[model samples]
Target: MTAATVLVVALGEVRSPVLESVTLARTLGTPVLLSLQPLSEADTDALGRAGVARALVADLGEARHAPAVAGRAVATAAEATGATVVLLPTSFVAKEAAAHAAFLLDAGLLVDVATLRLESGELVGGKRVFAGTWETECAVTSPVAVATVRANAIVAADAPEAVTTAVEPLSVDATLPRGLVLDEHEEHPRAEGRPALAEAAVVVAGGRGTEGDFAAVEELADALGAAIGTTRDCVDEGWQPHDAQIGQTGVTIAPRLYIGAGISGAPHHHGGMQASGTIVAVNVDPDAPLVQIADLAVIGDLQEILPAAAQAIREHRES
Candidate 1:
């Protein structure tokens, strides 16, 4: 008999891609869950709705601190369950953690899997390579394959259906490594309201076309109830905060809607937001590379266009 396949999912602040993975997992066999924390009743209900077993334990606790140590413990727990495939969010920490775990378990690591499937009795996944320019399919059958999935790329469904799912909570004893805490800063109260380009559903970004005028960028974002972003030039000019910038060196966003104002539509910039569902660029040059990629291109100065567009959206939403 062949080894039964299992996909272990880690819970993080990022939305789970359970639906997509579960659909893909069905093409293989039973997909059981390996949770890190003791799930609450609500979490249990969610897992039950998805028709999967819940194996809860205190995860590595890397969200707050201790990533390296947590990696070993998490990897040990995963190996103990004999999970064939491990799915996790694709973050800097998650990637490092997954890499460390796979190293410990002596498995192959497939970072940032955009798609997954069973091919020729092996697991095949689509990965974004070379800053999203090249897409390649990778397959692994190294006893257990570790993968980190990108958020917003797939819908998650933890609906429990079959009652035969064996719910098992895990317990492991591991030594806590000494960590250096240089400083502890107080949490901001209005942090949730802060415009985060990575997590923003919609992002309105400006570039050199703004020429130091970011007032309209913020205005447009507020009108649309979206987050504001900027290009390298804009950030360099001190027109906007570095945190709101989106480019090769800045935050990457895959928002549902991306509005580019006065941006030259540089390829480097496009690399950051190419995953956006709908792209709209407003530029006077009219022949920028992004113009071809944009769903709608407006040939006009951004200063005037931004305000008018913001007003129009505000009116439309109010109506």
Candidate 2:
């Protein structure tokens, strides 16, 4: 059999799955055509240079998601391109889309793929499940497979010999589910300048240990220009928004640096961040679970420690 074609589900964001997909695409072969939803011209241009030969842009009008539509369309496109494997970003929406497409094509579905290898005759993928403790290998039974890769799991390695390919624009029509209205999208003002919470190099997170005051958390995050995240307790107790939660039920992130303040570091909470490169904790209770996993554990109230740390970081940055 000839080299298998890989269809990558792209995020189309300014700095995300666009680079991620293209990198993996080059690893598979030369022709890495990107399928985009909606993004700026600048983003498209940048992606174009990243070895994306084609852009199969699907129009969904003003509706935020047309999953069924995109899923079917991507599956059809993949089949036509003779693709043997489909890859998607492991985000909430991309996960749903890839699974749906795999079902439509009767292909195997693999989630949370961390590492991939194109062997002599077969493709192998590595997965870390159950809060980064167990390492699992996934080898599909079907010829056509669908997999979603965890963010930051792979480096973007592009080849200089990549060339653009022709695009066969795909379109779809379907009725969406009820009460799923995307009336308007207020772009996160910070999205343009600040790093995304999931993509941040440094993340500052707070938990129930902070009690009700997140002032220190905010100050520290501001000083570091880091996105603020939180544990489930902070969300459940109404001290923080649900978006801030980081756990099995919340967002999973693999940032370079993660700082925990007033967070007890439950296993469920750590599950979302155990993949982080560096972990620091500041908790009054020395017995918190975070202390065990933390590279640096400080036994002090976050309220006092955070301000001092923030000042130190600021001073270092200035110097």
lDDT of 1: 0.68
Candidate 1 residue lDDT tens string, 121-206: 67788867776778798888687777877655555654445433455666644445467442443432323444456656678888
TM-score of each: 0.77, 0.85
lDDT of each: 0.68, 0.74
Model 1 misplacement above 4 A: 1-8, 14-52, 59-64, 157-169, 172-196, 199-201, 211-215, 219-225, 310-319
Which parts of model 2 have CA positions greater than 4 angstroms off?
1-4, 11-14, 31-36, 62-64, 157-168, 174-193
Query: How many residue-pair clashes does candidate 1 contain?
Result: 13
| lDDT assessment of candidate 2 | 0.74
**Model 1, residue 168: C-alpha shift (Å):** 6.6
Question: Largest TM-score belongs to which candidate?
Answer: 2
